[model samples]
Target: MALNVALLRASFEVVATANPRFVHRFYEVLFERYPQTRPMFPASGMARQEEMLTGALIAVLDHLEDAPWLTETLGALGAKHVGYGVTREMYDWVGASLLATLAEVAGSAWTPELNAAWTEAYGAIVSLMLARAAT
Candidate 1:
């Protein structure tokens, strides 16, 4: 399925503007829902991790139309995950937590359409990541 790039960008802007701690909330929701994933992260506080995630989200949303860049970036990222010990299954948990956090942060701006847009975008991202990971 194609991603609703416009909706994804607009909804992400709304969430980012509404809550500056969007990635923090995502990690909180992820850890809360799937405590086992916590060990995969650093305990020194999540500042760096949060920054990386926020940058990645913005990069993906901003470049949704650029397939070559997306493939190169996400492919390398997926390959890097192997060193981090990220399982293919963790992508699903991360996607769920991210969408839930976005919904909560977007508040009144959140819609079923927006949810589907994000879901589709995330699925495409995970597919690229996992395909590279398997290599």
Candidate 2:
């Protein structure tokens, strides 16, 4: 099934509304799960980290209804990430991080429907971004 654009946006809006600590928790879980990403981000950052994550989240979610843009955007993101030294494994790790963060702050809103929606949304991104990174 196609992913739900509204739910995806709502989920992001929900997370963004949370205390800034949610951002900290997201990054902590993400980095702990994939220490490899530590090099992708600065060593000492909280605001910068939140800004990047929140912005990226908004960008990805906003384009959920546009497949061509999603592919192109993700591919570009993949190419840019090459400079950050991300790997195919790291792309997969990023997906894991995304899901983990959602689950962490999702509360009752993180239902099966939300889970499927984000998984598909993130998977579409990972597929293209990782493929571009591979080449």
TM-score of each: 0.96, 0.83
- Model 1 spans > 4 angstroms off: none
Error (Å) of candidate 2 at residue 32 is: 2.3
Tens digits of per-residue lDDT, candidate 1, 53-105, equal: 99998898888999999999999999999889899888899999999999999
What range of 10 consecutive residues in model 2 has the weakest lDDT sum?
A: 15-24
lDDT at residue 113 of model 2 (Cα atoms): 84
lDDT of 2 at 8: 82
Over 32-129, each residue of candidate 2 has an lDDT whose tens digit, in order, gives 98776677677777678788867776787777777788788788888888877776677667777778887778677778888888888777777878
Clash count, candidate 2: 0
Per-candidate clash tally: 0, 0
lDDT of 1 at 43: 92
Q: How well does candidate 2 score on lDDT at residue 2?
A: 72
Q: Which candidate is the best by lDDT?
A: 1
